[model samples]
Target: MQILDTYLTKAIANNDTRIPWGSLKYLIGEVMYGGQAIDNFDRRVLRTYMNEYMGDFIFDTFQPFYFHHSPDVSYYIPTTQVDAQQQGLPMKEMCLGISR
Candidate 1:
């Protein structure tokens, strides 16, 4: 999540929410996970995952993050997971949702 940290840092420094999403998307999809993908399908999956999980919508604190959602249950990050130790405050564990 270093990329996210860097983006947050810059956002704070500039007092702007407008991230260079095009470049960030490419960096996440190609530079980060692309090399680990075994094949074209694998690469596509990585790209899709990045598109869904990484976006400007994340800046909206009013909205809750839903990694997975259904009528029965929804997975979300807990507010208590915020880590102050990082350069840009990041959750210690984003997938810690056990219920609700």
Candidate 2:
């Protein structure tokens, strides 16, 4: 979280905080699936940090496919300094399985 937050801080300072959503998606997948990247916990942890701290600005920018799943792009647009409670939006998540 520190590493990502550091990058985020720098990005925000530079007025270029928008990050490809696929990167995050892959990160989550890697965490859950392992191998593709550094596996950590499930997507929930990431979602808590990103979606909570910074507003999830979703877009159509698709990242290069390789990690084993597809996800929409989300710009880290922090509208408030506090972690806003997830309201209104239904709680839904996409789960993928390892390919044979």
Q: How far in Å is the alpha carbon of 31 misplaced in model 2?
A: 8.3
Residue 89, model 2: lDDT of 24
In order, candidate lDDTs are: 0.68, 0.43
Model 2, 1-100: lDDT tens per residue?
5545665577788997567455555444444433433435544555544453332333224532221234653323234552552352224442222233
Candidate 1 Cα lDDT to native: 0.68
For residues 14-100, what per-residue lDDT tens digits would candidate 1 score against the true structure? 988677777788877887767888999988877777787788776568997767677865555556644532334334444433232
Which candidate number has the best TM-score? 1
**Segments in model 2 whose C-alpha atoms lie over 4 Å from true places:** 22-100
